[model samples]
Target: MRVSLCVLLPFVFFAQTAQYTKDIEVVKVGVIFFNNELELVRAFDTAIRDINELELDVRLEPLKHFVSEDDSLTLQEFACELIDNGVAAIFGPSAKASSDIVEVICNTTGIPHLQFDWHEENFYIHTRNHKLTVNVAPAENMLATAFLDILHMKQLDWKSFTIVYENSRSLGRMELIFGWRQVHKAGIKLWHFNRGDDYRILWKLVSSTREKNVVLDCPADIITEVLNASIYYNMTGQFNQWFLTSLDTHTSTIRSLNSRQFIAKMVAVRVRAYMPPPVHDEADVF
Candidate 1:
């Protein structure tokens, strides 16, 4: 329904120092993102128009970059830059660990920071820091709720359902595992967070397990692998529903695959809160 996130600064330090606001000419909102999200980055930069539209006095300044789970040092190195640069407001450090790192930096430096909802738990862990923090969109529950709607739509029995997920350093990996458990604890036949094994070899479990419906929290690479395996292993016909995590953008994912075949199989968390209007160009944040 409704949720709020505020980017906050530490009170203890601020109490001793002069109010940090006077020196800055305009509020600067810093964003950190992945290299692959170039188009999405550009969409974020279109805030030139968003600023024009919202009429807010301050505007956003994105500091975008690529981060992998393996690159914690690089992430922390950049986190220090945001801290040293005195970013008046920082919007993101992107990944959970990177976001966590930035949250610590913000806590230490008393910088106000906000990240788009990856999950409420993510918000919960950092909200304690007392920085003005908010979740701009529905997190875990949005997917689980949409799934519950689909079950009702299909007239599907709850006992036939199961979920598969991967815990490979991605956001919605085990993030949704907890949400799924909390939301649907009963009549759930089975649940798993697929280890990053070669999926095709391990997927005898899919063929052997409850075959009626399966929902997954896997990325596009894993999803594509599982789909190919299902088609190859002859385990797909009985499925009434399948869920794909929002690990990849819909348009980009569609560009590579047969749109018609995937049309019914894909689901994603489409967050449109900051979207201004249909007329503006979308690639400015990159």
Candidate 2:
């Protein structure tokens, strides 16, 4: 099912308006997304249309700015421009550096910053007083705890496993699992792979070790490629189990991969319900 953005609009609007004058009839919301995030942009636009169809009392005007993922200066400029245009809240530019820049801008201006992507830092722990930022994704510690709970419930805690992560941010999601391993003295192996790196080498090493349990964490976009590598290495059989930590594991591409034989042993955990994008009918769409 496609998830409507209307469900979130009321809370955001009410929260933002509470801090300002309630006499306003129209609210301007700023959205900053990278040029590559067309799916996110489409989803946001769909949500806005859905909200408008409701004919609510307060009209929402979206001020969207598309910037290069790596352009920090442009991101800052657009964010400032949105603020100057009187946007009540800003969302997106999920890249870590860009998000940080927009977050600081929002914090300084007392504007709400809403994020829907995974982030390594926990503001509640690191910046206790930063109240202007809101993250829709699950916190890293909470996600780790859920992973631990799944391990226990599935009776996989006693078994040795390998953690295959794509980057430092993905590794950070496993921090609590690492602590659990230390306390329990469990056999856990760590393997890191860069985005474009060959996964055969990592899978070869894992296969040689005879590891049956695997925890895979990476950006959603490359997950299917990573799993296809595992399949090539004969790691998706009945004896092997895979756990995915990406919330977007349910995307159509991954779902198609999972439909093939021998992938039933794979499992995924997500805090938020999977909402198919409005353009899900299109192949490989996220």
Q: Pick the candidate with the highest TM-score.
A: 2
The 10-residue segment of model 1 with minimum total lDDT is: 1-10
**Model 2: per-residue Cα lDDT over 105-178, one tens digit each:** 88888998877766667656438434677776667778877777777754344467888887766766677777
Please give each candidate's TM-score.
0.61, 0.82
Query: What is the per-residue lDDT of model 1 for residues 26-98, given as tens digits with 9 covering 90 to 100?
Result: 4445666655655545655564344435433333444555666556787778767766666665666444443
Among residues 3 or more apart in sequence or in different chains, the pairs in candidate 2 whose N, CA or C atoms overlap within 3 Å are: none
Question: Listing every candidate in turn, what is its Cα RMSD in Å to the true structure after a full C-alpha superposition?
Answer: 8.2, 6.0
Question: Quick one: best lDDT, which candidate?
Answer: 2
Off by over 4 Å in 2: 1-12, 15-23, 122-129, 155-158, 182-186, 258-264, 273-286
- The residue-level lDDT of candidate 2 at 51 comes to 70
Q: How accurate is candidate 1 locally (lDDT)?
A: 0.50
Candidate 2, residue 136: the lDDT equals 66
Predicted structure 2, TM vs. truth: 0.82
